[model samples]
Every structure is written in C-alpha cells, then in structure tokens.
Target: MATNQQLTTIKCLILDHFITFNELSSIISYTPDLRRLHFSHRHERDTTIGSMSSIGLTNLTYLSLRIFSLNFHDFEIFIGKIQSKLITLSVNISPNDITYLDAYRWERLILQHLSQLERFSFQYPDSVDNEHRYFEGLNQFCSPFWIKRQWIFDVKIVDEGIVYVIHPYKKRCMSSIALTNLTYLSLRIFSLNFHDFEIFIGKIHSKLITLSVNISSNDITYLDAYRWERLILQHLPQLERFSFQYLDHVDNEHRYFEGLNQFCSPFWIKRRWIFDVKIVDEGIVYVVHPYK
Candidate 1:
C-alpha cells in the first residue's frame, strides 16, 4: 500500500517528463503549500497534456518551464491555469514556434497573471545561421516597460544557439520590495552601438560599482575610447572598478593601444587612480581602480 503522506508536505515540485492534466491537478491538490514548480521537456515529442478548468497555486513563488516543443496556444492554455503571485518566472520556448509579436502577448499574459512577480527570464533557441537577424528580432521582442525598469539585461551568443534575457521584476513604488540588488555587471557581446550601450549603462549607473565588458574587435574599430571615457566619468561617478576585454593584438606600437593609453593616462596621473593592463589568450584586459 502506497501511503499519501509524502505529497502533503511537498513544497517544491520539479516535473521533467510528460504528465497528464489530471496528474498535474492531483499533485497540486495534494501539495497545499507548494512554493516552487519547474517543468522541463527537451524532447520533440507531440505529447498531449490535458487541460484543467481552474487551478490555483496560492503559495507558488517560483515557476519555470522549458518546453521547446510546446506551441503558443498550448502554452497559453497551460499557463492560464496557474494562479500565483510568483516572485520568479523563467520560460524557454522554441524559436520556430514564437515570433516578435508573440513576445508581446507573453509579456501581457505575465503582467496579468503574475502581478507580484519580482524576477523574470526568457529565452529561445536561436536559429543557427541567422545571428544578426536573430539579434534584431530579440531586441524588438523586449518590452518598453522592461527597458525602463532597469533590468540587468543581456543577450548572449552561444554555440547551442540560445538567446537569453533576464531582469528584475517591476513593482510599484509603494511596495516594500527593493530594486535589483545588483552592483556589478559583465557583458560579452558580438557588437553594440555606442548610443545603445550608453542607454543600457545609464539604466544601472546609479548603483553599479563595477563593470566588465568584452566587445568584438571589429565592433571597436569605429568606437572612440576617449568619448566613452567622458561618458563613463559623467554617468558612473560612483563606479570604483572597471575592466574591458577584447580580442585584438595590442603591441606597444599599435595605434589602438596608444589611443587607450591616451584616454586612461590622464585619469590615473591626475586623479591618483590605478590603471593596469594584462595580456591573456591573445587578447588584452584593461583594468581601472578608483583612488583609495
């Protein structure tokens, strides 16, 4: 005889295989204090998970779904059953099944259902050959509200063809929830326009204490380090540590190296700041520390 005692005290549930709607409901009903739920399905099987009329997860604070084969309609239906004030929500879907317009719908659905959400992350499997096109699509998919909320955002290029964006949840000013507890930022991107970079950095400038960025050598050809120095000085006055890494040969005779020296030498000599350079893996790392 299988005793039902274990399900009553379950607070966290992680389901990786296919489950029917009735099974899901039974699990929920058994676990009244469930606080976290994660469902991940990586295979491309056409599995039918039946739907429930109404299901409430009053105690659920974290939810994550990584179903690459689920279509938009099915996903919407499955998510509609969840009624929880989730603090963190992460979803990963297939690129083939979602578009830029669909992202807007996802945003609206999240705002409607997870009203008290404090952290959100979304990603899709990138289509291998369309890096530039995928980048443009991902940017278009981002919500304006998220941009204004100072999300610690990122779009990484990886071998598995994955696009990721993560940010803190948006909340009303009266709410006791604090802003993102982030103080350091690190970015590795194929390319970023100067204006876009400036706008992105401005969002977290108030609390940022350290920054590290790795830009492609080709992207930095047109960038003016002196102009960037001015921008950093003006916007990130409280920033105490900074580092930049890139894959460009920087011998003593290189004009780029000279340019970097020209931009940072004044800050070090006049402000008693510390600037150091290191060569690593056929690249360079430039680090700057504020004067103590």
Candidate 2:
C-alpha cells in the first residue's frame, strides 16, 4: 500500500516475484520519477495478468533484470512497454532461456528500444563442465561492439562456475573499432592464447594507463614474460602500471613462473620500468610501474 507521496518520491525500485504485465504497468505508472529499476525472478511462477497496454518511464536511467525462467517473447514485450533513455542496463539470464538466435534478437531490441543507452552488460550462467564450450560458442557468434563506444569490457569467472561477460554497449561490430576513449582494462580468463592476446591488445588506440589480467595457463607456451613485455611496450606506449596474476598449474615444474628469473633479469636491464613479484596462495602477482 504505497501512498501517492511515497510513490512520487520513489527514485529506485526492486521487484522480485512473478509479477504480471498489468501489475508492472501499474507500479511504473505510480513511480513517475523512478530513476532505477531492478527485477529478479529466480523461480517459476504464474505471470498471468490482464491487458497488454504499454507504460512509459521517461525519467528512468538504469534497469537490470536477473531472470532464471522467462520466455524471450514475454521479456521482449515487457521491455517494449517501458520508454526510458537508460544510461545503464544489465541482464543476467539462465543459459536455458536463450539461444544464439535469441541473443541476436536481444541485441536488436536493445539498440532499437534504448536509443540513449550508454552502458550495457550481460551474463549467462555456466557450469564447470560446459564453461569452455560456452565461451567458445560466444567467441564464434559474438562480435565486439563496445570498442566503438569506448566502453568497459569485463569478463569475470566466479568460484561457483559462473561466467560473466559484461560490456558497456550493444551491437556486433562488422570490423575492428579503435578504442579511443578506453584508459583501463581488466580481464580474468581461464586461458588466453598468444594470437588472441595480440589481436585483443592491437585494438586499443587510446593511451591506456593501467592493465590487469588473471589467466589460467593452457597448453600454449608463447605467453612468456618477454612476449608480454614486448606486447605492452609496442601497443600500450603510455602504460604506467601493469598487474598480472597467474593461476597455479597442477605440474609446478611447467608453470609460467619457472622462467620468471630469466624474463625479469632482461626486462629489468633493458626497460625503464620498476616491478615487484610476489608468491601468493592463489598464484603469483607481478606489479610493474613506469620508472619515470
């Protein structure tokens, strides 16, 4: 039972239930000035309601949805009703709810509906056994679009086997877009191959100041420290700080740090950079700072 004064004063709202279309409409109608809205549905429930009327939230700036079970059509219809010039939008959906086709449709709907969007993020739940395949699928079908907008791109792997690929914009790029406004990038990946790494770094045209990466080693052995130093110096000439974390390997002898002394000795002598290395429980942490 929200009073008119309370509704008018509400700037943020969170709904976590099987809310119907009409119910959601009524709620939005009440909160005329709402700036942010978050909805989460972790369980299946009856979402039946009367009417398909659209409602606009002209003042809303942020929207998020964490959905476990919702049809794509329903989700699309729900968003179609709200007219908001959102600056940020995040969607986390169960993999079961969306296919690659649905992902394409989502991209189109987002670009069409939220014309003023500046930042966007998306995530699909993954299991340990299928994580690699899931990422591989994304690599094949998903094209990088956020680079054109100079938006932050983040991929986080949680301990619970959840993989999140969050970027600040939507759309699939037909070709490479130079990252002119990006200044910092942080990546946490299971394994990054050398060619992929080179291609990824070559896209940044801005004067990047900081970079951090946590990588799990794969069979590829080209990601040595010397190679990394060369790539950074060549691509990111204005880099001021670099942080690298390596996940431990089962065979300690073949671990990346085995050649650390060789890599650091030459890097220390040749480059005007100051760096430190630490052996932590998770793995090794290497921090490098510009000598200036």
Candidate 3:
C-alpha cells in the first residue's frame, strides 16, 4: 500500500522491494492523472501476483518495468492487465531461470500488444536476436489502426542486440522498420563486428541527425575502415556530427585515425559542432547533437 495519499497527486510512482505490482497497479488506477509508473518485481513462488484487468491509467505517459522472475506465460497474462496511456515505454528483462523468447514467440507475445506505443527503450541480458521485437513493435505502431503515422519521438537501443545486430549479424531486421518521426537515438552496442554498424546505419539513415554510440574496449579492435565508411559516413547523408570513443587500446591508432580522416566526412561531422571522436582510458563514447 502507498504511504500517503498526498503523494498520490505527485503523478509518478516507483516501487522497489515492498510493493507488489497488483497493489501498485490498483493505486495507479485511483490516480487518474498519474503520468509515470515504474516498478520492479521478481517472480515469487506463487504465479498469481498482479492483475489481469486494464489498469485504467488513461493519463499515464511513461512506464518502466524491470521484471526479474516473470516467465513467458506470465508475461502474456500480466501485460493485458497492464494498460498504459504511455507515450514512452522502457522495459528490461533480466531473466533468471527461464528462457521466454525465440524469434516467433517474441513477435506474437510482446509486439502484438503494444498498439499505441511511440517512444521506446529496451534492454535485455541474453541473446540479442530477441531484441528484434523493437521492429516488431514498430510494425504494430505503423499499422493503420494503431498509432498515428508520425508519432514516435525517440528510439534507444541498449546492450541487448550487441552480439546479433552489432556484432556478426549482417542484416538487422529492425533496420527496415521505418521510424518516420524519430528525432533522438542512443545506441550502445557490445559487438565488435562492424556488420552491426551497417545494420544500424541502414535502418536509421534518413531520420537521424543525432546519434550516440558506446563501443566497449573488448569490441574496439575489430572496427575497421570499410565498416566505418559503410555505417557512419555513407548512410548518414544528413549526419551533422559524429562522436566516437575507442574502447580498447588497440595498436591501430594510426590506422583508425587515418580511416577517420579518409572515410569520415567533414561536410557533416564538422558542420555539427557536437561531433567528437576521442579516446578515453575507460572506453569511447560518441555523442551527436544529443538533445535532438
């Protein structure tokens, strides 16, 4: 139960250990004007925890769920009960003892339900192939009956698809899901393979003016000239800035710098004052007009 009713008017609720999703959902049901709700819970021994009815959060604009113990079937049952008026949804699935998704199951279970979703942030711990659900979700968003055509705001993809999409995988399936209205994008991929960069650039060629990438030290060595050309310079015709960080102390400082000179375009990178590609002891981070 909530501690005070006065806080209810506050509109945002974040619950950690003590609160159950069922109780939290009910509390939000009472607060019609609530805008944000974030909750994390592990699957206890009992399967019956949260509600299956629409939460009636008609005023909700943001929702974050860090579900730990949730199983595949439980996810299906709970999502229907979890309704949101949200324009942004951030979900992190850190599975414990269960494997809930394959490619097909991901399409049917998660993406099918998020009809009105716009801005999205997602993180996953295991294999990245499941992260294709973003595109799957985007498909539903673009469906004539779902959200309006030009509604999404930002798309942030985190460490989940590093292996499959950013590593060795050549064709990022999500690249085809058109984000006609996206303004801001933040990506931190873990894979060293340059092919993922191809998929990243291929998917977001037109709508992106601002881009951020976090390349870890482990994956930094594999970055090569051709990959940089294909992913960063060629695809982003409208790119105004380029910011990059090297994750590892690879022996190719001369090679990488030469590649940056040869392949990188000053027409766009120089024009965008925010573009920066520098090395740091910890790792490399490139930020491009992060605001928009």
Candidate 4:
C-alpha cells in the first residue's frame, strides 16, 4: 500500500516505486488537490483495475509517466479515465510498444482530451537494432495538425537504438534558452538540477526583476544561502523581488536547520525577505517571502 492515512492536502508527488493504474487511481481518490505527479507505471501487472471506478483529478496539470514492463491497452484505458486539464504530459516508455508510436492515435487523443496541453513529449527507449523496419515511412506526424502545433517528430540514432522523440519545436537550446529581455520568471520544473538552474538564470539575469522558484529537494544545498547569494550577486543584478520555496519529505534531516541559518545573514536581512518553515501532512515546507 502507499500510506495508511488519507493524504488530503498534498499537491504534488513523485513516487519512487512502481504502481499499477488502478492503485494509482485509488491513491488519487484521497488527494483531490494533486497538480503535479510523476510515477513509474508497472505495465506488466495491474491489480484490481476491473474495480477501478471513475476518477476525477480536476486540478491536475502536469503528469510524467515512466512506463515499465509493457501494456499499451491498459494504458489507453487509464489515459481515457484521467479527467484533468493537463498543461504538460510526458511519457517515457521502456520495452517499446508500437501502439504508443502511432502518431494518429496521439493526435486523436490530444484533440479529444488534452486540448489544453501546452507541452508534450514522448520518448521510446528503443531497442530495434534494425531501424529500417521500425522507422521506415513513419511520416504520419507530417500532417497539418502537427505542423500547426509545431510539435516536430525527431528520430535520433543513439546507443539505445532508433529512438523517436516527439517534442515542442524550440528555436533555441532546450535547457539553456536565452531570455535576456524577460523581466519576470517562475520555474516549477521538478527534475531541474540545481546547477542547470544556475545556468538558466544566468541567461535571463540581466533583465530579470522578479523570480519565484518552487523546488522539491532532499539535498541540503537548496537551503544554502551563500549559494543563492552568489547567484543573485553574479547574475541577478536587476532582481528586485525573489521567493524560494523548498519542499522535502525527509523526516530526520538535522542539517536543515543548520543550512537554514545561512539565510538569516545580513544579505537576506537587508533585503527584507524572511524565511519560515512549516510541516504539512508528511512533508517539510520552507518558504522565503517578502517581509511585510
């Protein structure tokens, strides 16, 4: 099971273990406020999916699935059952299923249910050594539907095999896009590495005035004010307002308080931003907000 008690207040989750589609629905029944979810789906074994009732996740906007084993038919049912206004959806498939590679199915699904989607990525962890058999004449994504959305179909030859990735077309680099003239930014990426964030901020540094970052981390580096101070000094010269919200599920990390002390230094004091901590349900939430 996931947990004994009902999780009523949790808004985001990244499950470490694999869960079947039905079990996932059961868990979602408890948390109505869930917005972002990342989980490993056990495709080979789905328990009690027959008893799975209609689930409503009205607030959910972001979803990432790492599909393990193999079951495309079950997944189609699961996807159809998911009722939400999804803004971003990503699926990484292992033990490739050709059903998922069908561009026509995706276009239909998106038009039917995911019309609100702004970004979508499909990754096939390819194993077809003979790329000709798999990728030959697979140009169904060239229709006006995909062209209007600017979602390009890209096939790359890597160590993994002939991998086809469907992603939003970008004019600049994927991670290091330069937004030099942008003034305000809010980042909610769950997998954004801390250092990569530093590089992203550097590019937008000159014109940025307001920044808000929400990150879930078990790493103590997130609480280090010195690191943030260095970043603010070196890159965010124009920044006038800043907020950092850190979340973690660690129960016994004693170093949190020690690392939090760094934020009390003169740099923060002079800026009139105060940091506070809260324990919610089963996780620790630390927030830095403008002193009022």
Stronger candidate by TM-score (1 vs 2): 1
With a 3 Å backbone cut-off (N, CA, C), the pairs that clash in candidate 2 are 120-168
Residue 128 C-alpha lDDT in model 2: 66
Query: What's each prediction's clash count?
Result: 0, 1, 3, 0
Models 1 onward score TM values of 0.54, 0.52, 0.42, 0.55
lDDT for model 3 comes to: 0.54
Q: Write the per-residue lDDT of candidate 3 for residues 40-106, one digit (tens) a residue.
A: 7656654454443566567777887877767766666666666654567776777442334233453
lDDT (CA) per prediction:
0.64, 0.66, 0.54, 0.79
Model 4, global lDDT: 0.79
- lDDT for 263 (candidate 4): 82
Stretch of 10 with least lDDT, candidate 3: 162-171
Off by over 4 Å in 3: 1-8, 49-52, 97-100, 127-292
Deviation in Å, model 2, residue 112 alpha carbon? 1.0
Best lDDT among the predictions, by candidate number:
4
Of candidates 3 and 2, the better by lDDT = 2
Error of 4 at 33 (Å): 0.8
Measured on C-alpha atoms, candidate 2 has an lDDT of 0.66
Tell how far residue 163 is off in model 1, in angstroms: 2.8
